[model samples]
Target: MTVVHVLLGLGWWLVAPRGAQGVPRPFLSLHPSREVTLGDTVTLRCRVPHPNVPVSIYEEDGEPKWQWDRVEDTAEVSVNVVTRDFAGRYRCQYNMTALSRFLRVSNPVELVVLDPNFPPPVMSLSPGGRVKPGTDVTVSCWSTYGATFLLHKAGISAPIQRQSLSRGNTATFTLYGVTQSDVGTYGCSYHPRGNPFVSSHPRSEVTLELEEGGPSMDHPVSQQPAPRPSLSLHPSEEVALGDNVTFRCHVPRKGVRVIVYKEGDGNYRWQQDGVQDTTEVSMQASTNEISGRYRCRYEILAPTWATDWSDPVEMVVLDASFPPPTLSLSPRGHVETGTNVTICCRSPHGATFVLYKAGTSDPIQRIVTGNTVAFTLHGVTQADTGTYGCSYRPQENPFISSPIGTSMTIPWHRDTFP
Candidate 1:
């Protein structure tokens, strides 16, 4: 009798077949594809060269999940309602009783069961008006989760067209020279690629209506397009890691919906706010992911027209949480009235330094230069006798600022010099 044992490698237990090196392993394949929507049926086929062979399918290192006593050259295993438990790597092995007791193992294939609760793709028809028979028709499908898209007709069991690639969660299907028979409802669904693929559920559908005769010359009058909105960041574009920044989108028109977009967000709108022409959205710079290109556009709900996207603006987040700059006074601590005192702030990196007096909203002086900047206070008086601190913003990123450095107290007194 031959025995099969398990071996551990790379933190995973692998079972190797004890079949002879010259023997060929069984071939494993999926019926529809590697990805299946939840509650959908999927079939796994195991084929061997000879008939009446014993085949068994195993997942990972567990025991056989399916077994076939004496199938033809091919054995089929079906999953009626695919569930979360059916999502994993599967492999098949077949035993040859007459040849040897050892089993021949086949290569593993991954099965991904998509989630049923995820939102489906949106379908839209081009040439919003009636479509003519001899003219080409285009159907577009867009979704937040985009990978592989399938265009399905109402009465078709299989997809009419399949798109292997998509442009940022959007795919377009064209029907050439449509006829009267082409008048039907069409819908689309997509499968997003990941560890476990995601399927678009509750798909959206669109209908195609053909014009009776010659194309109608009575086209709707064109209206002016909406004006583009301007986008600006409060407190500048560059911000500190933990700070918050507000994105302001403004346009000339009023009572319009404003939409914001982040570069890689695909078909999903990043954010929307304000019924008026102007809108403000605040976001925290908690992670590096927040740093990206952003733009905005305004739409008129009554007319149902949107303006072109505005110019893109980049936001940069700086990690400025380090040791504070050093503050030093030229005259040490105490200073006499009618005398000159120089206060210098030094930081590790080249930055702009600002000197602030205690209990004051405004800074005494702000200087933009190298790593160090000095403030000269001539004819110092009683008013200068207060605690002062200095903060610096890196020259490369002016919007980001470091915490206030150590403070120093200056004592004021009457001039007693010769």
Candidate 2:
């Protein structure tokens, strides 16, 4: 007798323990289908497809999470108490010596554990302005529940710094005299001071900007003359709608009031005064107001002379008014395992699109091309079955994600006989 069974996310059949009499093919299974909350018991059963074979298990991209003793028929691995770390993908395999074939490995199984008490912390960049080289920048991570904070820069493996928030749940990491090298994405996470073992999810990311010289009229940094402040956009020339877009105008010489403006043919736009030091000005962009160009300049007090306006920065928008992209699966309605499926999204006006599966925040694939975006999924199995949607943002303004407009369903692929 040969054993055949379904495993997590494995859409098709696996090669069984070949030529073995009465041997069951092993597959990794979890007791809790949805989530294993705190204190919940989760059981992982490795049905020794082969009569008596030793088995091993790994979690998340081949990290050994758990393993079991050699069992003749079946091996049961149970987590009496579940933690946040246990919430991840898992797979297992076993060996059958008689057939000279290695253990048939199972597909990956994802485990989710919800912890409501320790929510992720929030990270903010302070004095958020046009940071010049040799200027100081401060990054702060704050949490209501956790006492320990971890700061991460884009490339560094370990946390750049792990600090205890001695001040009322707020930990501040300051980078003094920043340079072009410090220009990259940054984020923060927190773990309970006492638990030490459990860590909350990381907060969103932020970036520090730097340019060689100040912005100039109709240019990024100023080019006119010396002693003038330059202005630029926090991100690139493009900006998304409903996103926190910031414009900064700064001078190497400190102690000045900055004003940002949009220049046009005999018309313009600008900011308020009475602000001192390096200050960040945030504006909520509206659809009607987001079109056209922006520029900024600084005013030195006492002398009362204003610097030349930095070059105009174009602020693009992923116009919400543009029709949203459409999602469609190949073969129309239902699909089966081992069938190569094509997921296509089209937009007449969009320059780029992102495909997102249900329950996941990050897009599976991002297409930066013409109107049509296609993601081909090979032999889609159970794991790929879910509601999927796609949205397109103007390539220059990717930060503004279009509101999700359409979703398609991938039914569980069932084995069928023709």
Candidate 3:
């Protein structure tokens, strides 16, 4: 009985203390649910109920991994500014003879690190200022302050080019063999030693413009120096009847004078001679007096040189004859319901005729004939009464007709009489 009692006491003490309260299950907790970017830190704690048992703490998938002992009920693990590789699942466990419970994985905390010191680099191409396919081009990446630089391209999973410019903050990425498939958006990143790395916002966007077979400008003039003497004209293209237009000439280079002339008008109408430097000439638009092509000529008068006429540019004066087109009302200018009225279009000389009604933008109808044309208004009504006009297209270079026609208003109440 004494021996049995001693054995029973020892067994009870060992079993009861160990099974009831050897050490509470290990627990892991995090101070912050999320970590700040770049220059921030994260703290992870492992809690053990009893101070007698040993505790080991280390980080996995971060910098280095190790095991530690002697924590005194709690163990703290700290890491600074997590990186892309540091982003993953982490766990802490208490080990005495074997691994203890995992403590619920510490809620899977995530550490976010941002870089505020380094700014994104700027990228640019040279030569034509446009990215062309199958052409050798250079891409330059320049940053304000960064540690490492990387350049990525297509077909390659990793960075195709890299440079370690420890001297300055600028790096250049050269593509030795360029092709059509090489066109794409490129990104760059900068990482310092202790701080987190920052990626630029896709600064380089490459577009491929293929060269088509054509007579391209072989020696195209990117820019031209100011001419010795310059001439300018108002109403460069289109002009209206009775509208006055002006022409001016200026000498950008010294010792040059300008002469103005009106071509194909029998003889030169006006001439300004020996006019040192810059001079101008003007012409009036007349009904029958002025009409044809006009141009200017520059002469090195003081330097004893022959006069050279600049390119010939043409202008036309518009006139559709006087008294306009006479619009005569048929059937005594009044027609009964369901009756037809003849609207004849007449002018002196018009290859094409356009007729319109007052207050309406679109032409009522058009007629193309030698000199005169006509439109028959079937079932004439009160809506047909309004002002009317006719214009003619000339056969000459101007190709625009004169704006002269007739205006007539038919009474709406007259239709009720007949």
Candidate 4:
């Protein structure tokens, strides 16, 4: 009796044959291996060596899958389209006929079928996609860029494999094994690192079919060209202070993920769901961050693909006066009568500056300059001992002004007769 069993772990487990070294066994094998995605065409090759014999293929003992009469050497079984039910361990045998003295049974090979609810990833085999039984096989998963990845196989609940992302600007994962458990559909997905909740909308799927009898096989990852998404500010060019504004991202096609960006030193991001064609994001133009350049891009889930950044859409924020104008008096302490007291106002981004006295709606004076503005009260007197304030209009925008910068004053009385 041949000893065959396995130790289970993260990798797939399969029963190994006990055939002696240098001993040849008529074991089942697959060509290009049977791993296939849903809707893919696959061919399972069965090899029956010389002396002219009939061959029989089965899913397991006493469960025949197919048979061939007096076949020469090789037989090809074609699966038009793969489905989940097609997944199983298969074996092939030969010569139950009178022309041959012995009936030989081959080892089993699992036909693992995978169907992707999302998009399937391109798989590649290292050192080649095929390997003999007992030898290691490397199944590398490749796509544009994905963060964390997961590997799945037929009938298993939890992920059969997991791989963290590698930097150097690459999104690939590698699974190592050559066992029956490894035979099935394999898929992966990615999200921005640190974000475990939101994964890419589409998954990357791959199916790896194991060969029966002799060796094993796998494939190399595939790469595709990335797409580019366009972005714009609604009301395109500029936004007014305190006005409702929007940032819209547009992709060439629908069903893709679009990310909108504003140049921020430290910005937390937001996501929008069910994006049909364009992503519309709106916010009030209240902060200094309102005006600047913005752009957009997109990503494809299944393919693990991304597009280049769209052309930048510059935004001009109207009136960005938060830390309002600074109002200062030259004779800051106590102003003596018959001396000039200069009130100066300045704000980094303000376009116009105005000086206002308390209890008056009319500005004492207004100046048109993005820089400093000064108004001098000549020969300060008791009448000019009122509160003074300064304000500014930013970027020449309508209805946008800085908060009032107020200054208190008390003029020292200089008596004509002491």
Best by TM-score: 1
Please provide the root mean square deviation of candidate 2 (C-alpha atoms, Å).
20.6
- Candidate lDDT (C-alpha), each: 0.63, 0.57, 0.46, 0.52
TM-score, every prediction: 0.36, 0.32, 0.27, 0.27
**Tens-place lDDT digits, model 4, residues 237-313:** 54557788888887877787666654321152345545778988898877755555466666554533345456666
lDDT of 3 by residue, 211-273 (tens): 443112231211231343445667642345677767766654455545555442325444466
Off by over 4 Å in 3: 1-232, 235-243, 273-278, 306-308, 320-348, 352-401, 404-418
Residues 211-330, candidate 1: write the lDDT tens digits. 876322232212343456798888867677888988888887787767776544334244453456678888788865576567777755443445555766667565656457776777
How big is the positional error of residue 70 in model 4, measured in Å on the Cα after superposition?
0.4
**Stretches of candidate 1 exceeding 4 Å from the true structure:** 1-51, 58-65, 68-82, 85-93, 98-114, 164-167, 195-197, 213-418
Better of 1 and 3 by TM-score: 1
lDDT accuracy of residue 70 in candidate 2: 60
lDDT of 3 at 315: 52
Question: Distance from true position, residue 337, model 2, in Å?
Answer: 0.9
